[model samples]
Target: MAPVRIAVVGLGKIARDQHLPAIAANPAFTLVATVSREGDGVPGVPHFQSLDQLLERGPAIDAAALCTPPQVRHELAAMALARGTHLFLEKPPGATLAEVAALQGMAQASGATLFASWHSRFAAGVAPARSWLAGRRIDRVQITWREDVRVWHPGQAWIWEPGGLGVFDPGINALSIATHILPQRFFLKSAVLEFPANRAAPIAADMHFCDTHGAPIHMDLDWRQTGPQTWDIVVETDAGRLTLSNGGAVLALPDRTERDEDREYAGLYAHFAALIRSGQCDVDVTPLQLVADAFLCGRRREVEAFED
Candidate 1:
């Protein structure tokens, strides 16, 4: 079978760090081109100032991966699907649930695979952690995803924008993993958002959620932490404690034994390749739905200004 020809839209930090490397490593995908405004063209591949130009001039690419911000994902996704190409979208599929649903409809009608890739759900230890929790009763869960954005994101301007998602960007990853590992479907109970005084979006958020069966999950997200970085999710159950650290890369059981390394992006692309080959679609919006519910119900509080 021929490798799927892939073109990536939005050549930002994630596209550089995760998507490109994953595509390069995957035997089923070929990096054919990229769409970027500044045009840091990928070597031996074409670069376009926008998706419009890429679609107009590039070779026959089978799939288009959107690494752009959530706000604009809908239009790009719709365009690709209409052009008879499969799509791979970054997390937080679209700015609004309505848009994602619309894209799903269009994809089905067009017979194109629409994959909303939540990379964190593909973490190295996620599979094992999920299996461990399957038979046990989950009691409580706590998630903390705090990092110094200046160190990790640097001068990324879109992060603080209205539709850029701010701190929830990382927080959503935790939600995705939590949703995947938990046996029961959950709903939001309450939330509080801490918006930067001078910014349009929140810099921190604290959310509380519960399952229909009454399992409580608490989430804390901050972009201002400066010390040793922390990205962890701990679940305490009737059996024992299951801690997934380094953003689900390391899974440590209660007995102090740890397992595996990170393979988030690689796993996502592998899934994407398989979906495209098998004529299937994978779009899980539970995490993004939680985010939307929080935004809809939470009261906003203005906090200290953040500048990169």
Candidate 2:
């Protein structure tokens, strides 16, 4: 079968660092064009200032990976789905749950595959972790995801805006893995969101959740850590403790520990290709729903202003 002709909309850090490379490595996809408001694109592919320009004058594409910020994703996704172009949405899907749901409806009407891609759920250890926890009794879960925003998201002012998820942008990745691995469904109990004095979004958050079985789950997310970063989830089960570190790249169980190379993006693209070939849509909104709930029920606290 011929490779799926794909375009990448958004040439940001993630597009360059993960998306492009993954598409290149996957023989099932061919990069036909790229779109971004600023900065150069792939050396040889056609580049556009906006999705409108691409759709108007660029080569035909079978699919597009929307790497743009969540705030503006719904429009681009709707445009692509309208043209029957398969869509690969980066994490958080959209700024609002309703918009994403609307996009899903559009995809269904257009018969286009819409994949709300969650890279973290594709991490090497995530599948194994999910398999291990399927039959085990979950006692509790603790997630600590801390990183230096200055180091990771330098000069990204949009992240502090109303539609930008801020700390929850990264926190949602953890939730994606948690929701996938944990057997029972979970719901938020209470949350405390710490916003920087000068920013519209929170820089840190502490959340408490409970699974259907009454197991406690705690999450601590902060974007202010300076030194070595931390992304870990510890789950206490009846059999033993299960731990996933390095954002689900490493897993430790009672018998042994497993670590694997970073292949999250590659896995995502592979799944996208399969979905396109099979004529299906995968738009799980559980993680996004959890974040929305956190914002809805969270208590607000102001912290020192952050500058970057």
Candidate 3:
């Protein structure tokens, strides 16, 4: 089959670092065009200021990968679906759960493939870990996701804004892996969200969770770590212990260790390509819903004002 003609919207760091490379490496996709305000697209592709212009005047496109902020994702996704273009959304599919549900409906109505890509869930170690834990009872879960915003996000002001999601932005990636590999689903039992004295979002979070089977879980997310970063999850089962670190690229136990190169975005685009070819949609909202639940029930605590 011919390569699926594709366009990437929002030419920011992620688009440049991950999406563009992934699309180029995957023969299943052809990066036909790009949408960025500067018209500063990849060397050989045409660039448009808006999706409307691309859909109206450019050559036909089979799919679009949206790397825009979650706040505006729903509108762009709806527009693409309406035009019968398959959609690939970055993690945290939409700013709100309701918007994602609506986008799911729009994709269905238009028969367009809608893939809410969770790059972390596609990490190399995640799938094998899930398979290893099959039918095992989880006794407890511990998650520690701490990173320095200055190093990773730099001057991303939106991260502290009302809809930016702050620490949960990176924390959700952990949730994606946890939800994907765990034997049972869990829900928030209590949460303490630590917001910077002046910001609208949390810079740190402490949460406790439980599953119907009485299994307990706890997570700590902090955006103020000064030096080495950490993204790790540990789950203890009836038989042994399992741990995944480095955002799910590394898996370890007391006796064995395994590591893999980060091919998350590459895997994500491949999955999107398959979905487009098969005329299917994958819209798993469990991770996003967990974020939503934290926002809904979390108790707020004001802390030292953060400036960056």
Among the numbered candidates, top TM-score falls to 2
Off by over 4 Å in 1: none
Give the per-residue lDDT digits (tens) of candidate 2, residues 1-308.
99999999999999999999999999999999999999878899999999989999999999999999899999899989999999999988999999999999999999999999999999989999999999899989999999999988999999999879999999999999999999999999999999999999999999999999999999999998989999999999999999999999999999999999999999999999999999999999999999999889999999998889
Winner on lDDT between 2 and 3 is 2
TM-score of each: 0.97, 0.99, 0.98
The best candidate by lDDT is 2
Per-residue lDDT tens digits for candidate 1, residues 55-86, read 88878889988999888788888889998899
lDDT tens per residue, model 3, 1-308: 99999999998889999999999999999999999886489887988899999999987899999998888778888889999999999988989888989999999999999999899998888998998888988899999999999988888887788768999999999999989998888999999999988899999999999976899999999999988899999999987999999999999865788899999998998889889888999999998899889999999999999988
The C-alpha stretches of model 2 lying farther than 4 A from their native spots are none
lDDT scores of the candidates, listed in order: 0.88, 0.95, 0.91
Model 3 sits at a Cα RMSD from the real structure of 1.0
Quote the positional error of residue 107 for candidate 3 in Å.
Answer: 0.6
Pairs that clash in candidate 3: none
Is candidate 1 or 3 superior in TM-score?
A: 3
